[model samples]
Target: MSTTTYPRRHLGQGDLAVSAIGLGCMGMSDFYGAAEDERSLAVLNHALDIGINFFDTADMYGVGSNERLLAPVLKARRDEVVIATKFGNVRAEDGTFVRVDGRPEYVRSACDASLLRLGLDHVDLYYQHRVDRTVPIEETVGAMAELVKAGKVRYLGLSEASPATIRRAAAVHPIAALQTEYSLWTRDVEAEILPTCRELGIGLVPYSPLGRGFLAGAMRSADVLDANDWRRQNPRFQGDNMVRNLALADAVKALATQHGATPAQLALAWLLNRGPDIVPIPGTRQIARLDENAAAATLGLDAAVLQQLDQLLAEHPVAGDRYPAAGMAMVNG
Candidate 1:
């Protein structure tokens, strides 16, 4: 029971309208650190209670455990939630990274496996987690189109794809959304990828809209992260990079204070103001943090504040690459 209601935005020109802010469910199962199933289940229900219906997950998250985690919730709230999950990024049983697989056969099998794990007949939106460089975009999207024909997926999306690849894929089928890492700190998509998406009538779904919690003004030091947390290995969260980024986070905090909002709210508000077609899914395992983030949907920012944030980030540009070399190679393919 939420006193504040959230507005829905259509992902592209399609009839698929979801909450303005989505919940990214990756960290709850893996990547961040250890998490309790009971706690994660509570957060999922709480999200729906607070008017959040867009749930983003992927087959690779927790090496499939993440999809299993959502099965019970999806079963109970089948009609209320618009579940979006991804495929293409393959992983081994021990959680070792294999390779990006966009082969037609793999695409079909992956969708079946994800549906089985999710306990759902069809997913609202399905994405190719990463572009498989070895395979042509046409071949990969062709298989995805088949899924849509069979009612396995309502809409199709592409993540971390290059502008050219996006064009090629959209030519084959209408791309409902483009999920990329976008935030005040990560604006690489703005240069070309975003324009390409807009040109083709595809909405933008920004994952890690809070810079993977960096822009939240938390994590004063890299040491604060657990030993097994994946952020520890991220280039931006290590050594001198972490020190420099903390200053940027503090600046965001000060601006948020001036606007009577939390740093996470300010960050998400900024993205919400970016456009009506852009929806950002910020991940959190804590109910309090989820509420704090969902509130950003109602936190409005005027032109002056938006310009000020733009200037602050411009003056103090973020340090370090977004990912390590191996991981970086997979994006923008």
Candidate 2:
């Protein structure tokens, strides 16, 4: 169990409570660049020490390497932490995403494999990483509900699903949370998806709340990214888009200075103020950066500052789609 209890947020309708600011463990294994296991483990341990109990991972994160990386850490503190991992978004042995698979048999096998990797009997929350359009939402969620019924999972969630699909899934089972890319610049959910979640009483877990570290004003251009960095392929970090997006980052930096906080803190504070039903999981590989993200839970953004930040985002409207063309095809399903 954790020595320090962090502030909590409830997902969906049940009594499931997790820390308001969770740690997204994606970067610890893959995507951004190569990861040092020693450094990642330290960051994970520090997250628990500082009261971040909710840890997010996915099978495809490192083609299962990410879950393996988290296994030892979660095994030691099984009772204290809530481990959330996703299936679907299938990937090949080479780590290239192939297609989404929501077949009932695949679901069963995936959960079992994930449990093996995490060294846990049950996962706290399980999400369908992406909606498999070929399979009906009801069928997919039905298979997930079985995991809950059998004690393999405690709660169910969907990532990047459309409002209609969410409604359908909720009809089959109580959807706990919707994990989607939501940040200062990514507000597409606000129009319909967010309000729909509110009506259904489902909580929102905003992934990349710092705009993939862009809103922190630390990244100036795509040139700054290592050749292997995934952000290099992201549209918003490319050529002209990179130039325009940095302006948005500059605005956040300006607000951060006025509010006596780092740009990352200001960005997360804005998300926390959006509603109590929202939880933002900001990932970091560095121990110092982890503390900075956890501190955002305590940074309060008042109405005026929020308004200024809102206007800044509205005026700039960001430069490109949150993902590349192929990745974009998988979202809002």
Candidate 3:
């Protein structure tokens, strides 16, 4: 239902380009809360209708079910869309994420399986969802580079990789992007990882750019999440931390009102203003919400507005760690 067409942004140093805001498809099949297949498909179609072609999913999302879910639309429009998915984060039979695996054999098999599920011959972008410290990054990325040579993947990326790991990976292959948890609330990457990506000419793809929907004005407290919601286990959404973070959301909402935009738009607009090399993948199931997010591509924030927003976050300082202790151990590997 968007009346305006979207603008495109280049993801890496390559010719690879996508809508300014890509669609993060993980929520359609896993995480967040309960989801209906019909609703998810509707949202996917709506995204395309509104000019979103960069779709992100992971092999572990729903234990390979996410890629299966996107197969139909992708098969129909393979040439029109850019498919980006990740491997690593080994899952057990019972669906628990056990560890990261970057072995060459696993990388090959994972890419093959993901391609089969997506009904595609080659993915536009393939990423190592997490770095496996046990395996040398050189060994891992050397294998990933083979996929590109074999015509299985066009570009490579890494998520939550440390700056040193990024350099090591890029030594083997060009890392088109570094998808990490980055937003108004989670700015730790700015201190190091972001600048490294800039120097390396790798694009910054910020996942959870709306702070897992908190900055989108969707969550006010832990009580608002479904009982089975993953956010319930996340530190930022629990108890006292939730209350403190609500104030951050309130400040964003206030700025949103002043700009005549929704909180989601304001949050995403701020990211868009960060640099041309940055693109945020904000996921949602509702068509209206997708339209609102897409509109953010055109919502310009001036230096004064950006400064005010930054000041508010500096004064308030987000309350909890971005992830739980166990989850925290895996990032920036």
Off by over 4 Å in 1: 1-4
**Model 1: per-residue Cα lDDT over 1-333, one tens digit each:** 344477889997789999999999999999898999999999999999988999999999999999999999999988889999999989999999999999999999999999999999999999999999999999999999999999999999999999999999999999999999999899999899999998999999999999999999977887888899989999999888988888889999999999999999999999989899999999998999999999999998999999999989987799999989999999999
TM for candidate 2 is 0.99
lDDT of 1 at 41: 95
lDDT of each: 0.94, 0.92, 0.90
Task: Using lDDT, give the best candidate's number.
Answer: 1
Which is the winner by TM-score between candidate 1 and candidate 3? 1
Q: Quick one: ranking by lDDT, best first?
A: 1, 2, 3
TM-score of each: 0.98, 0.99, 0.98
Alpha carbon lDDT at 74, candidate 2: 84
lDDT at position 221, candidate 2? 69
RMSD of 1: 1.1
- Write one digit per residue (lDDT tens) for candidate 2, span 51-110: 999999999998999999999998788877899999998999998778899898889999
TM-score of model 1 (CA atoms): 0.98
